[model samples]
Target: MKNKLAAGLLGIFLGDFGAHKFYLGKPKTGLLYLAFCWTAIPAILGFIEGVSYLLSSEENFQAKHGRKY
Candidate 1:
């Protein structure tokens, strides 16, 4: 998806279930996040991660998301 902002927002909002992590191809981390999601740590961290994603440059985001130039 081109809209990293939208995905990041969704990650912040629904990252408790590791939805964002899944979308980003981090299934292992996503599962862990999902497992401990009830603690709210994943949610908070996911929100911060989302904001960081938004703040990062496009090339950086593409790399994180596994996109090619």
Candidate 2:
């Protein structure tokens, strides 16, 4: 299962490289983030998403991301 805390931390730290997206099993999205990282938009979005993930409950996260791939 994907860990919300881990995802959140990654987003806040390595999100510029799309680390959080990769961790969430979204390779395509991760690559997109990488592509636009130079623009700094990904970093901002990642931070927001990270906070959203941290604030979300397990059930909500699971419901949105699924239980198992």
Candidate 3:
């Protein structure tokens, strides 16, 4: 299972390169983010996603991601 803390950290720090997406088993989206890493959009989105992950309930995260972190 993926770890929420790890994923959140990755997203917050290396999310421009889609590290968190890869960790979450979303290679396609990860590649997309990587391809667009030159833009600031990925970083902004990643930060939001990271914070959302950290704030979300565990059950909600599990239900959405299909596994516990």
* CA-lDDT, candidates in order: 0.80, 0.90, 0.88
Candidate 1 C-alpha error for residue 7, in Å: 2.8
Quality of model 1 by C-alpha lDDT: 0.80
- State how far residue 44 of model 3 sits from its true place (Å): 0.5
lDDT of 3: 0.88
Model 2 residue 24 CA deviation in Å: 0.5
Query: Which stretches of candidate 1 lie above 4 Å from their native place?
Result: 1-3
Candidate RMSDs in Å, in order, are: 2.0, 1.3, 2.3
Candidate 2 TM-score, true structure as reference: 0.91
On lDDT, the leading prediction is: 2
Q: lDDT per residue, candidate 1, 1-69, as tens digits?
A: 446876688687887778778888779989999899889899988888888878888877877685546
For each candidate in turn, the TM-score is 0.82, 0.91, 0.91
Pairs in steric clash, model 2: none
Candidate 2 weakest lDDT stretch, 10 residues: 60-69
* Candidate 3 displacement at residue 57 in angstroms: 0.8
Over the stretch 4-47, how does candidate 2's per-residue lDDT look in tens digits? 99999999988888999999989999999999989889999999
Positional deviation of residue 66's Cα in model 3 after best superposition, in angstroms: 3.4
Clashes of each: 0, 0, 0
